[model samples]
Target: MAAPTPIDQITDKVERLLLRHEELQRTNALLVEQVHALQAERDSLKSRLMAARARIDALLERLPGASADERKERT
Candidate 1:
């Protein structure tokens, strides 16, 4: 069998590089989508946390004999 010419070798290398570039582009797109989903999830969790904190504060305010000084001292 004849060995590959330099041009043939370079062509093969170029093809491989193009395939790698395409694969990396696909992977990057998926990563970006995942990051956006995670960001939305984080925002939802933060809002939920804030709502829960508000409810706790309201409950604490309603507690019998729970003075403002005691709440400040506990924290």
Candidate 2:
């Protein structure tokens, strides 16, 4: 059996570290993409909510004002 040299061990360690760094970089990019996708979905939902609110307001405006007789009829 032969013992490994110090230089060879250092080289192996450096290679492993570089591989880990690359993996982390790829993971970060994926996370960033996911964040952007979620933000776009949030904006779309907000727009839809605003549009629905406007439609409801318009419908209310078109109807005649409520009267005491209409309120009494409900009961």
Candidate 3:
């Protein structure tokens, strides 16, 4: 059998590159989706943290020691 010509080799290479490009695009899309999901999760966690902090602050205000402001000023 005859060996492949230069044009055939170049065509093969181009096809491979196209396949690789498509693969990378798919991977990039998946990564973007993951980033969005993670960002949403992080925002939810931040909201929960803020709520917890508010609850803790309220509890501190109810404490019998000096007022919250006075305690902060002393520290």
Candidate 4:
């Protein structure tokens, strides 16, 4: 069999590099999308946590004293 030419070796290397580049690009896009999705979910959870904390604060403020007996008597 004849040995491969220099051009063939260069072409094979280029093809492999291009394939690797394409795979990396795809992975980067997927990661970016995941980051955006996670950020949105984090923001939503933060808002919910804030609202829950505010509700708890309001309920505590409405109560008369530290003791449960006072709350029961008031009710």
Candidate-wise lDDT, in order = 0.93, 0.85, 0.90, 0.87
What TM-score fits each model?
Answer: 0.93, 0.73, 0.90, 0.81
Top lDDT hit = 1
What tens-digit string does per-residue lDDT give for candidate 3 at 1-59? 99999999999999999999999999999999999999999999999999998887777
**Where does candidate 2 clash, by residue pair?**
none
| Candidate 4 Cα outliers beyond 4 Å, as residue runs | 66-75
Steric overlap count per candidate: 0, 0, 0, 0
Kindly report which residue pairs in candidate 1 clash with one another.
none
Compare the candidates by TM-score and give the number of the best one. 1
Which ten residues in a row are the worst by lDDT in model 1?
66-75
Give the better candidate number (1 or 4) by lDDT.
1
lDDT of 1 at 3: 100
Query: Model 2 segments beyond 4 Å from truth?
Result: 66-75
The alpha-carbon lDDT assigned to residue 58 of candidate 1 equals 84
Q: Model 4: what TM-score?
A: 0.81
- Write down the worst ten-residue block by lDDT for model 3: 66-75
Local accuracy of candidate 1 as per-residue lDDT tens digits, 1-75: 999999999999999999999999999999999999999999999999999988888888888998998876764
Please estimate how well model 2 matches the true structure, expressed as its whole-model Cα lDDT: 0.85
Better of 1 and 2 by lDDT: 1
